[model samples]
Target chain A: MSSYIALFGNPNTGKTSLFNNLTGSYEYVGNWSGVTVEKKVGILRQHGVPIVDLPGIYSLQPLSRDEGVATDFLLTEPCSAIVNIVDASQLRRNLHLTVQLLEFGKPLIVALNMVDVAEKRGVKVDAEKLSRCIGAPVVPVIARTGKGTKELVRAILSLSEQSGEREHVAIDYGQDVEAAVQKISEQLPDDLLASKRWLALQFLEGNERIHAYLQTYMDIAPLVAVRDEAQQALGRPLAEHIYDARDKWIVHAIETSTVIFQQKPLTLTEKIDAVVTNKYLGLPIFLTFMYIMFMLTFDWLGSPLADLLDQFFSGPLTEWLSKLLTLVGASPFIQALVLDGIVSGVGGVLVFVPQIFILFFFISLLEDSGYMARVAMVMDRFMEAIGLNGKAFIPMIIGFGCNVPGVMAARTIEQPKERLLTILLLPFMSCSARLPVYALFAGTFFAKNQAIVVFSLYVLGIVVALGLAKLFSSTLLKNESSIFVIELPPYRMPQALTLWRSTWDKGKGFVRKAGTFIFGGSVAIWLLTYVGPKGIGVSMDDSFLAVIGGVLAPILAPLGFGTWQAGASLITGFLAKEVVVSTMNIIYHAKDMDLLQGAITQHFTPLSALSFMVFVLLYIPCLATVATIRKEAGSRKWTLISIGCALTIAYTISFLIYEGGKLFGY
Target chain B: MVLTDLRQGQKAVITNLAITNEVVKQRLLHMGMHEGEKVCVKCVMPFGGPVMVEVDGQYICLRRKEAACIGVR
Candidate 1:
């Protein structure tokens, strides 16, 4: 029989890294999951057994959706054995879960992960002593280096056969609570999964799960009434007092066994965090960092690469295609459809791959370097200022790269209301995918002030996000103050392997999304224009798409953008942000240099082009983002509200930019 | 002192958690805020709102109403 072991731990404890080391596979690693807050399990093939990595969580208790999955799997399924991964440096905090698992009475192997980190921090742990205390086989392993992991697995296999009856090591609570636990245990069924003592303690503490369990399983009203009376007589809620007493006992145990010197010299991470997370300077530093990031995205790196790509695809590729068509004797309609619709549409959008890579690369570097945590800290105060919870800032920061991942990051926030609010506002943060459309217009029309134009749009995204967050928090979601307590992992020089892996992962996602959605959309746009009515062969300026664009033009005329080119991009942007640039390519016959140059000068004024860029910047996210929002929010109402609000905001901002610029005689 | 009575920036050593539930107890332990840990009040929401307290160099914010239920000394 093959054995299956599930590895579990808290966030930022190197759980994923450990799994990757053990499995030799690159699973997505983040401070939080990118989808419905559930454990993403990836199986590792061992010699004869399989290892599953569970999501990192603080406890088996279901505080969030991820935790719930971990809790459910452990209780319901009978795994051959379990490995509890612990951050050796943070053992005191990590041990709490170890104690909880002890109650389960399953065969557990302790993987003392990051032992090197603990040693570096001058914290020495006696794994032998710890194992004896917890009645488990403890292996002091440095998971990053794969040290002691094989031994740890061997220990788990050895213990798998000895699981029937183990000594129950009861935690010391005070007499009254212990007495209440004893009374409650007598009333519970023998076959119940949890410890009778624990369940009784839960009942005394007025635990919601226990109450529901009791109500459903047994006619325990009388017993609960008696327990309540006993709790009242004790002059306290039974649960609170017991937990407090247990805490004191655990502290004593740790103090007796675990030696700690708190007065250690400040580490290098602290030196950096002190300056960056400074109460006075943090906000300014955060803004400066963000400004630099936006500037670099457009000016420093993105511009040169984008220009080169544009030249290659637009200048050379288009000219070559036109010459080829002339030789092949292809009809004008077919040539236009093939060159303008397919090549210009899809190929044009793809030319901005440089900008997408730049954005995701920087984000990946920040995340790997641990600067993202500091960003979260700086933004927490500002988020609180806007009446948003601190936990909600992470998803919004993530939204700067991509709304799909941003919406998925909402799982960590815990509170349903706050999670929904974060999802609704995520699309408003300028995603990197939106950069191509901005690059096209700003590169063409606002070349003199490209950086400023790009920077202003990013600022606009923030303003719109904050506004939407405020609106949602105030009306749709009540003022629920969800607490934020995030762990600050010590900063290290980001591992080069990790950074490269992350950057490549994000870049690959961009390429994949382009290939799947943008490629298909581009081909569809090509067919539409190529096969349209009359011998005119779907002139982009007079095609069915243009007619629809014209119909929507008047409503947006005040925004100084009634052009079919701008209107058509907005329509395709609803499919995917990448498609916006491609859609413009199709309409403008961008692959044909003469047609591309002529179409831009004849059809679009600089102000209308600016309006168009602003519109794309603030417009609705791709359909995937909408579907994710609907799934995560668990209601169509919030999703619909998000879409409606995004469109309205996009229109309003474009209107201001276009009309305001024209009024100022730009 | 119970958490409800602790003022902002005041330090209190948790003598008792006062919540008897095993899950809650496990969570408090997991958070490193179990008994004997010294916690300093960081910020209290306006109008006796959710209280933010720092324990073991980490801050945890909870509603004042929930704090009132926890027994701390």
Candidate 2:
């Protein structure tokens, strides 16, 4: 049998990096918490076993979906050995989970990570002493740069070879709690798989999920009786006492196994946070960073490269593809599909790849530099007004990159109402997929201030989303928990390699999307314009794309850009936002962006172009997002309401922008 | 006094976490803020924002209300 090893740790402890080193696979690693919200499995080359990387969770008892994912996997998943990663700098707190894992009765090897960081703070840990104390093999390793990883791998393989269970070590939970734990363990059914003491302790600590799971196997009445009896005798919640025991043990363990010296004061992260997270200056600093990012992407590097790629695809590439088709004696229909449909459609979306990567680069920087958690702290006040804490804002930041993961990131919110609200508001964050449409329109019409123009749309998306969050909180989902406690990881300069890898991870999806479904979508769309209800080779005006677009056009006229071509593009945009540019390219029969720009000018003024971008910014999310909403929301009614709300808000906002612009005589 | 009652940069040993919410209390404990631990105020954001607190070299940001539930001396 192939053995499986699970890598577990607290959030932001570099477990993903360690997994990458062991498995030789690239998974997105973020310095902030909750980056890995689900379990990821990769094969470990050294041991020839599958390594499961679970989410970074503070405890086995869950308060949120992501935590539940990790907790569930730890309790239920079958693994021959467990490699528990502990951040040495934060060992006291991280050891709480380490104790629970030890109680899990598995062959465990503890990987003590960040020892160098600990040493920097005048703390020195004796790995041999820690190993002796915990009764597990401990190896110090730096997960980021592969320092001391060989020892960790050796320990893991040696333990895997033994195939023996570690002795289940029970923490002294005082007298009453110990009595209850013993009773609960004896009463537990034989069918139970995990350690009975671990489950009973978890139950006493108010792990409702485990409690519910245990009820299915046994009556649980005897256990509940023992718990209530223990609670009455103790005069404090068993959980608090359990934590008290853990804290006492940690203090003792630290004294015996570690040494502390006077620490260096005021690191670079502190000096920077003094200004960037200052009361008055934090929001301004955040806005400035965003402004700079946009300026780089739109007005500087990204736009120029995108323009070059656009011209190449529109002129030389299209001409070369056409000639190749002619040389092969292909049919006129096939030639049109390859050139007009696939090339123009996919090529139109492909040109924006540079901008997508630039945006990803900035996002990765913010995430890797540990700025995102501070943004949560900085944005807490406004978030409170919307009935959420600063922790909820992390999902919004992630949403600016892509809504699917952003929506999934909501799993970390801890509050069900807030998680749903975050999901509902995510579509308005203006994902990178929509960047192409905004860049095309802004570059074409708002040339001198394209950066400012695109930046305003991003701000608009936030304003509208926040406003709706406020509305939903007051009317639909009332009584938020308003609990916000977040860990602030120390800032480090983002490594160049990590930044490149992260950017490529996010940006590759766009290109792969273009190569796969978007290629087919483009061909299908071109055929819609090529073959209509009037049959093959009908005029675009009479094509099926036009017929459906015509139905939606009048409704959009009030928001400007009411033409059939614009309507058809919006219709295809439902498939994916990049397809909007593709549909427009094919409809205008434009060979290059220069031609596409000239063709759009005939149908839209600068004001109308701005209005059209606004609609795309707030309108319904792509099909993948809608499916995620359906699944994550877990209710058909909520999903429909989400779509309905997005459409209503999009129309209202676009109408206001268009008519309001005309009223001001712009 | 409560955790938020401390001046910025003032350090104190935690006496108790007088919090009722089960999840919040468990979370604070798991984050290494149990009784007898030491914590120092780092900064408090302006206008009802979260207060940044440092405990054993790890920084944690907590809402003012939640921070108030933590007793220190």
| The best candidate in terms of DockQ | 2
Task: Give the whole-model CA lDDT for all candidates, comma-separated.
Answer: 0.70, 0.87
Which regions of candidate 1 fall more than 4 Å away from where they truly are?
A: A1-4, A30-36, A46-52, A75-78, A153-223, A226-237, A240-266, A314-342, A592-598, B1-30, B38-73
Q: Which ten residues in a row have the lowest lDDT in candidate 2 chain A?
A: A164-173
Model 1 chain A poorest ten-residue lDDT run: A30-39
Model 2 TM-score, 2 decimals? 0.97
Please write out the lDDT profile of model 1 over residues A1-666, one tens digit for every residue.
Answer: 444677777767767777776667776564332222455455554654567677667755566555666766664555766788887777766776676676555667788887777766666677787776766777888765678867875676677667566666667666666766777778777777556765675567564545666666688877677677777777976655655665555566556555555434336755786577655676688788777777887888888887787778777787888999999999886686667667776677677788777777778766766666556655665576565766677777778788888887887776667677788888888887888767767776777788898888888788888887876677666567544445555666766777778777778877887777777888787665555445446455657677767777778779877776567667877888878777767766666333454567576788888777777877787888999999888999878888888888888877887878878998
The number of the candidate with the highest TM-score is 2
Tell me how many clashing residue pairs each candidate has.
12, 0
lDDT (Cα, tens digit) per residue for candidate 2, span A1-666:
554799988999999999998998999898888899889999886557899998898888888898898878855677888889999888888898888888778888888998988898778999999888888899999988989888787888888888865665567888898898898888887776588888888999888889878888878888888999999999987787887788788778888899888676548878998899887899999989988899999888999999899888978888888899999999998988888888888888999899889999999999899999999999988899888778778888888889999998888887889889889999999999999999889888999999998999999999989999899999888976666778899997799999999999988998999999789899889989988898989998999999988988888899888888888999899999989999998998876788889999899999999989999998898999999999888989988988898889889888998999999998
Query: Using alpha carbons, what is the TM-score of model 1?
Result: 0.85
